[model samples]
Target: MRMKKVSFLLIALVVAAVGFFIGCSPAKEPEKMETVRVAEVTRSIFYAPQYVAIEKGFFEEEGITVDLKTTWGGDKTMTNLLSNSADIALVGSETSIYVEAQGAKDRVINFAQLTQTDGTFLVARKKPEFFAWEQLKGSTFLGQRKGGMPQMAGEFTLKKHGIDPHKDLNLIQNIDFANLPSAFASGSGDYVQLFEPQASLFEKEGMGHIVASFGKESGKLPYTTFMTKESYIKNNNETLERFTKAIYKGQLFVDTHSAEEIAKIIAPYFDDTPEELIATVVDRYKSQNSFATNPLLDKEEWENLQAVMKSAGELPQTVDYSILVNTDLATKAMK
Candidate 1:
């Protein structure tokens, strides 16, 4: 009876010890997720890689939860960034230059470029059997807002083709960016510049015909990029590195995947637009190599962007590429 009692006591003690140890052990904590607020100039198929990153779990994988907002125009997007309403701004590199020219206390920096070429397309009311640059002369041209990247690039291309936008065409610049398509549809101009899938949608609706691409004519530029204030980079270096990594992954996915696959993945973002139309726009951008395959913004592209701005008389003085751009995060991300 004593032996039986002793064995039971031993077993009970062992069980109790085990239970105590199990209960005293520390519990694992959940991973911390950082929220990054992004203000995009506008939402379009032009920013496909960014959409790919968000939809493919790349940003989530890097512990980032994106809070994206469309600010409609560069001015509004920069306003959001400067006011701390957005931590990041996806806009033209020229905005940064303009800010720097104005002597901002905390200068904006272009860390990762998203587009290598312009995104606008020239849509004509009537499809020309043989389209030429000279055809724009004496016609009412509905251009983008003055001093914006699209308008600057359009002017640059027009000069290249020997048709001065101001002298040869009746240029209209007062229309709001969002209303350009509607104005064109309501019989506003002989030609209009637009970003996809609006251009594609217009063609589908028989509202206009795509005659030429500003993206192709303007050559390679650091047209669209992801930028943030310099102070943000200094404070959130690690977060910025992770953000660039996700951007790089997004770029790779777009490069490797077909337009159909990309369109399918990013379809949710454009819920109102048809999948077929998305694919068509994606294919068009892909074919023209509009999307940057990587995040690094090189010096040559920077110089070209400046040239376009200078030609448009929008640039007061050229800002050095090194002062406004930092590729360190992009380099670390790629590795």
Candidate 2:
């Protein structure tokens, strides 16, 4: 009887051990995801892939969550990044150069460039008379007003061609972008400097012709970039790398996807633009096949711009090229 009882106890102990082992054995837990906050200076069809990445969960798939913010222009965008309100700003090289000149090294730095080619154009009246740049010498240019991008861009273009903008051209200021299409349709101003989609609008209105393409003159003006604060890049290096990789992926997507698809992705931001118009613009971009993050700033171009800015009395002193752009993090991400 004693032997039988011992045997029964041993069986029970073995059964308990098996149950404990089965219950406590490690089971795989779901992977923890990382989140990244980001921002953009403006909303345009140009930045469609970023919206697509967020909408399609590409960032999430890469273990990140991106919170994107948009501002009015470069100045406001810089403010957001400096104040820690944003982690990135898609801004012009001109703006980056100005910021770095001020020695805000802790808060400001450029990562990778977004577009190599300048997408700027001067739209003029539709007539044989307005076909050439020389004819545009004395024309009234509808600009963003004094100290605005259009005015400066116009001066750059004019001066590059050895035409005196101040004496030879009339640049009107404070023109609203939303009203530019109708303004041009009414022939309010003889010419206007426009970026994509809006440039397409001028073409569609049958009122304007592109007298000059900025890309034709400037090899690479550094139109837009991925900017970040030094502190963020330092503390969250891994996060930055993942974010940059996601952005490159976004660039690839932008290159492949159709305009209609892009328009659909960015529909939330551009409430006023018709889908048809967006489709037209995207198709145009496809034809151009212009997409890049190459931060190569030509030395001669920089010197030429500096000379122009100096002649226009825009720069107080010569800005160092090295301080103006940041390509390290972006290069790493691409690799």
Candidate 3:
């Protein structure tokens, strides 16, 4: 009977050990908290892949619940990021560089580059004399905002052709994108750097002719970036990777998809724009090769963008690009 008791206790101990092992098995990684916040500036057709990622549940598949916020411009989005209101932002390299120089925040790191191709075009009323940059002297140039992409493009284009933006011609700021074509129609702006769809619209309406394309002239400068605060980077590394992975997927989608498919995805944002115009805009992005890259911009390209901004006086001083770029997570995400 004592022998039987010993064997029973040993079996009981073994059962308890097995139970404990089953109970304490690492908790299955806790389902990976599905929540994130991101922001993008402007409502344009080029952002179709981002919309596709969200619409197609790419973020959801990666266990992320995205809260996307849209703002007026990259400057405003930078403000939101510095204030810690948003986690990630789709912004231009020039705008972010200016923000870093201003010392708004210690570390607003830009990881991935988007939009290798600059899609800026100068539109003006068709005249025999207006075909070249030299003829633009003494004309009223309407610009979107001070230090924005349009301004930088205009400055670079003017400087390249030996025309003084400040002396030879007058540049008016605060010209809204929607109103630019109409203003051109009324002869309010002699020449304006308008983006796609708006640029296409002016051409279609016969109000303006494209004087020059800066993308063609400037080679290729890194136009936009996916950025975040330094604090976010340190604490939420996994979230950043997931976001980057989704973005890479979005870029590939943009590369392979049709114009009609792109228009369908971005149609919700541009309600007022006609279907034909939307198609044109999507085709333009495809034809011009304007989308964010996988693992984004490299160090040299980033510096080149800063140089362009510096020449345009967008940045007050030469600031280090390291403070505004973090590619660690993006590199990991690519794999």
For model 1, what is the error of residue 261's alpha carbon versus the real structure, in angstroms, after optimal superposition?
1.3
> Which model is ahead, 1 or 3, in terms of lDDT?
1
Kindly give the number of clashing pairs for every candidate. 0, 2, 4
- Residue-level lDDT for 183 in candidate 1: 97
- Tens-place lDDT digits, model 3, residues 1-335: 99999999999999999999999887666566577778888766767777778777778778898888887787688888888788888877776666666676556778876677667788877646537678889888887677777677668778989998889988787667667767777888788888877788888878787777776666566677778877788888888888888877877887888888777777777889987789887887677667664756677777767667777887677666566677787788788
lDDT of each: 0.96, 0.68, 0.76
Give the better candidate number (2 or 3) by lDDT: 3
Query: Model 1, 1-335: lDDT tens per residue?
Result: 99999999999999999999999999888799999999999988889999999999999999999999999999999999999999999999999999998989999999999999999999999998999999999999999999999999999999999999999999999999899999999999999999999999999999999999999999999999999999999999999999999999999999999999999999988999999999999999999999999999999999999999999999978899999999999999999
Candidate 2 stretches greater than 4 Å from native? 1-29, 105-107, 145-150, 176-182, 257-261, 293-312
On lDDT, the leading prediction is 1
**Candidate 3, which segments miss by more than 4 Å at Cα?**
1-33, 127-130, 174-178
TM-score pick, better of 1 and 2 = 1
* Candidate 2 lDDT by residue in tens digits, 124-238: 7765653667776778877654543344555777777877777787766667665666676776878887777778776777767776766555544455667777777688877
Top model number, TM-score = 1
Model 1, residue 301: C-alpha shift (Å): 0.5
TM-score of 3: 0.84
Ranking by TM-score: 1, 3, 2
**Candidate 3: worst 10 consecutive residues by lDDT?**
124-133
